[model samples]
Target chain A: MTEALLHVDAIETFYGPIQAIRGVSLEVAPHQIVTVLGANGAGKTTVLRTVSGILDPEAGKVVFEGKDIAHMAPDQVMRMGICHVPEGREVFPFLTVRENLMMGSYTRRDSDGIAKDLALCFRYFPRLEERQHQRAGLLSGGEQQMLAISRALMGKPKLLLLDEPSLGLSPILVQQIFEIIRRINQEQGVAILLVEQNAHIALKTADYGYVLEVGRIVAEDHCATLLGRDDIKEFYLGQKEAGVRGQRRWKKRRLWN
Target chain B: MEDAARLLQLVVNGAAAGCIYGLIALGFVLIYKATEMVNFAQGDIMMLGGFVAYSAIAHWGVNYWVGGLIAIAATAAFGYALDAIVLRRVIGQPQFAVVMLTLGLGFIFRAAAGITWGYDSVGFDTPFTNKTVKLGGLILGDDNLSIIAGTVLLCGVLYLFFAKTRLGVAMQASSQNQLAAYYMGIPVRNVFSMIWAISAGVAAVAGILLSPVSMIDVNMGFLGIKAFAAAVIGGFGSIPGSVIGGVFVGIVEQLAGYYLPAGFQEVTSNIVLLGMLFIRPQGLFAERMGKRV
Candidate 1:
């Protein structure tokens, strides 16, 4: 994979007393769009949190650009060019849209670069430009999601860890978000590690995929190959074999139909 | 005409005193907003500011203006250190634990002040001391006027800083969502320490402005109780609300003292505080949702 950009080696993360992600080793090549597909309670969010330094792994290492960053603080991880857009899009509700975007670039000292990146964000989401002065709390759910991604983009991150961008989004919006994600990876070369339950679009947009089941990687392959797997269809795609059609497996996940 | 002048005089006097409460309340609000920790020692910090100014101006023969500025800076440094070394350790603990810790810190500050600055009440010479200005038919003490003026200036700067500046907005962001601010590459822990410094500086300004009207002593920090009431009435979250609440408390106390019998003046703030709790616990300018104290 032309040398990995972020290599997560057999990490274990504990959320309080409960061990969330265990022995989960995965690698993302530079500028590659990687997707981790999992059902509810499979530790998808935990995996991203561990890599982003929100939850430090009890065991194993997260090597970013060949530097060991395990157990570092979230701010330090961010300063090293790993930005995490956490679950629930925790944007500053009181600040104006433009102010929220400015916050994303808080580490940067160059005014010109910040200004250019700001313009770039607005171009990506014209809706944000129209309401730059409006309070972010007042934005619709979809608009807030757009703002969330745009805010992360403002950091000019080398690696972006996005947790379920499609959660609570419309089908059209999901498609649009993935399309933009694809464009961002290609144009900006910001390698993305996205965790999603929406298997269809995730398989379509990502270059590589990992199937996580209960704190473990069950499958790892190219997106196209993962798409062609029968097990992937049954469990994630919500489709069964011809004779077993309409009779779903009890373990089948709730997919975006 | 005499009655009108007396009422205006009472209002100005009340407002001046209330500005002190507001300033102290401001310290609480700043720290609370940024860190969700209510510093009960905020009043003691104000006391320290005044005592530092006293030493700088009277003992060392520094200019009053320069001494006051130095006191503010020195107190700010103390506040920063207090957070970096002490309060920073208490993050993520229960609110009750923080409340108790800060309350304990207040007693320690008092004892420390007693040892450092002595038990006796001290006063400093300000440019406005003993001066009076006649505006039309009314006479106003420069001490009272200076307090009002200083508050206006400080509040203006704070308002502009939080509204217009990048670091100020970043401060707002840090308080609203710490994890998000960290993701933005802001050093949230450091930002918190900086907020502590600013809060301490604001408390120091209150101490300096209050020198002529009141004496600076180890017990001067008890005024923080009144300021706490002021913060509650201002919704505990809003900046301007706390100041206005202080002014309101001050003006009401003055009116009660003038109209009612003697000894009623002392209980007036407590009564107002209790009444506000009963009538509007959320405060006058409360946000839609309040974080539980």
Candidate 2:
């Protein structure tokens, strides 16, 4: 593997007595869009949390840009160019949209560069420019997602780990959000590690995909290959099951015995 | 004419007292903004400030002005140490736990002061001139006038600090969202420690200033309760609000004592407090940034 931009090795995480992710290993290659597809409670969000240092791994290592950052603080991780847009888009509600954007560049001191980056954000979402002075809490779900993405962009991250970007979005907005993700990956050359529940769309957009079931990677393959596979199609890709395919899906095969 | 002059004197005296209460309330606000914990020990911390100055001036023979500065520094150091050793351990704890811990701390400080200074009340000599100024047949003590002027100066300085300085903005941001502030690379833990230090320092100044008016005693810490009332009258997090609240409480209390029946004065002060709360639950000048979530 050509030195991945972000690498995780056999990481385990827990919430008190309950083990969340057990020996989860994953990687995202430089400038590649990698998707981790899993059901709810499959530890998808936990993986991002561990890498971003919101949740520390009980075991294993997280390597970012050739540095071991398994135990680094969240801000320190961000400083090292890894921005996590957490699930639910936890925007500072009382702050103005402009103030929320300003907070994203809190670590930066270059006034000219910050101003330029802000202009760039407004260009990406003209809606943000119009609602710049309005409080962030008043924005619609789609607009908030745009602000979240733009806020992360202000951090100038080398890799963006997004959790459930399409969770509460409408279908049209979901498609638009995925398209924006693709454009960000292409135009900004920033690698993305996306964890999503919208399987069909995620599979379509991702360059490579990991099928995680119960905190373990059940399969890893090129997105096209995964999408075409008979077993994966029935299990995740929403293809019709059984009669025509006779695919030996693991869950079905196990049930027959 | 004599009665009118006396009324003017009482107003001036209450204003001076109100300024000190405002300064103390400022300390309360500073700590509350940073930690979201009410430091019940603020009064004891102020009492400790007075004792520190007393020891410096009496034993070390330091100039009174220099001794006052030393007291502030000593109290700040003590506050920092308290944060590092005691408060830091219980951070992110439940609100009740934090409140009880600080209350216990306040008691410990009071006990320590009792052990060291004994039960006797002692007078504090200040550097400010004690001349009485004549105005419209009323005499205002130079000390009282100085207290008012000093309070205005301190508020102005703090206003500039909060509005203009980078550190002040960072501190304000930290108060707004600590997790976000940490993620933004602000040293939040350090900010917490600094806030406590500054609070203790402010409390010490109030203690020293008040000592020349009312003799230093263990009972002085109870003034924190009145200061708490002041803070509530003004918005809790607002600097200007606290000052105005303190002065309003002080003047109202004085006016009630003079104009109302003997038993009614105490009841009237509380009545004013309740009236303010019933009308504006968030206080008259709180920032309108409250959120449902």
Candidate 3:
């Protein structure tokens, strides 16, 4: 009922001639966590990239805080308080961890607010504080993920578009990162639009979920309802039935239509 | 004692020349760092700066300091315009195209300078003309001392700029990963233009320093080839490495010209460059870490 913090209308994106995302629409309310669940090459990353203005969409709109930012540059999008933690944790390799965090606040001019944010980032990820002077490339995968998330937080974003937070991490680290994500959402009241392959944790953490196939959103619902669906269980939750793969595939096609 | 004094003098002279080469090499590193494109016009830009300063001082009758400032400003604007007009269009193109574009631009700049200023070598009058300073046992020319002092001062300023300033850090961030920097609210295109401008400004300073020692001419742009070798030897990514590499090349060239065959001065830098390529293609201070995933 209330207005969404971010509204993504039916956006169509392309890579040269090949269309990557076709008419994908989504929304995230203030302080809510919405997850987009799909397998690799299902246009999950493309959706995030389109919203973040890295790749301009050929159609539809990206409205952030009631402003149409569909044609803005990536930096202009970030200036409007939308921070994107891209896939692969592209932290500056040669920069120290502290400097990496500093880069997150590049748009801000308030020194006091920046200092506060830096302290807050270090508090959330104490390992960052411990190796604040160390180059970011030297950090372990889990640590780098933490640094990446914390770096996004430093932007003081009203909405965070996370590409993949649990990518290439141990189970324990995934849980830890998800816990931090939940805490960040709740404590900071920051909205999140998360794209993930780990449907279990994503469904557990997010309030709403969307299922994407190829470049289209096939299904979407409240997380609790979606988690209980048969298709979601069979496809995303890894519920396997011997000799039923083809049958399930046909059934899924029927369901999508 | 005489031998020691002679060696010290050679070292000092080599260091002065090396600093000029390093200044030009710094331009190469700056542009290469920001865009991964080598600007072959760097040396020609230096020559252009020298001519600009010469015109300002000789024809316009401006003060020496004012002329130097004009030279730096003019060259910086030219560099910025070059990036904005030509290089910006071919940003994501192949490296070979960028290289050839810059090489062609270098030739254009050289020809422009020759047509504008004529081919005759001209002397630049500086305040330090014919001045010399006596050290403990050695005589040091004011020109060499100023070159060394100018290099040290410029390096210090650059170090502080990169370490302490926000715009400088943003430039560094953009150089490392432009997309990530853009996501972080840094205008990456502006940062690239600024890098080119600063590089050109630095090259101009090198030209101003070199002009007082050697005559200013279009052929002075050929010195950029040596600076290119210096950049390769120092590791293209490292700023400090460029200076050290420049100095090493300068010393080798000086010593070779003195001790080896008459034509060996020109070949010494290439020999060192080939040797560096064979032994350590990554250069002396190249980052050892594998690319991040």
What DockQ, on C-alphas, does every prediction get? 0.68, 0.34, 0.81
Tens digits of lDDT, candidate 3, B121-237: 987789876799999899999999899999999999999999888888889889888889999999899889989999999999999998779999998999999999999999998
Which of 2 and 3 is ahead in TM-score?
Answer: 3
Worst 10 residues of 2 chain A by lDDT: A248-257
TM-score of predicted structure 1, chain A: 0.95
Candidate ranking under TM-score, highest first, comes to 3, 1, 2
Assess the local accuracy of residue A11 in candidate 3 as a C-alpha lDDT between 0 and 100.
94
Best by DockQ: 3
TM-score of each model's chain B: 0.97, 0.93, 0.97
Per-residue alpha-carbon lDDT of candidate 2 for residues A165-197, written as tens digits (9 for 90 to 100)? 997999999998899899889988999999999
The 10-residue segment of model 2 chain B with minimum total lDDT is: B177-186
Contacts from the true interface found in each model, as a fraction, amount to: 0.85, 0.32, 0.83
The per-residue C-alpha lDDT of model 3 at residue B14 equals 87
Instruction: For residue A234, give model 3's deviation from the true position in Å.
Output: 1.0
Residues A1-257, candidate 3: write the lDDT tens digits: 37999999999999999998989999999999999999999999999988888999999999998999999999999999999998989999888998999999998989999999888888778999999999998999889898889989999999999998989999999998999899999989999999999999999999999999889999999999988887888889987667656674776767766
Candidate 3 chain A: worst-modelled 10 consecutive residues by lDDT = A240-249
Q: What CAPRI grade goes to candidate 2?
A: acceptable
- Model 3: lDDT equals 0.91
Assess candidate 1 and give its lDDT. 0.92
Name the docking class for model 1. medium
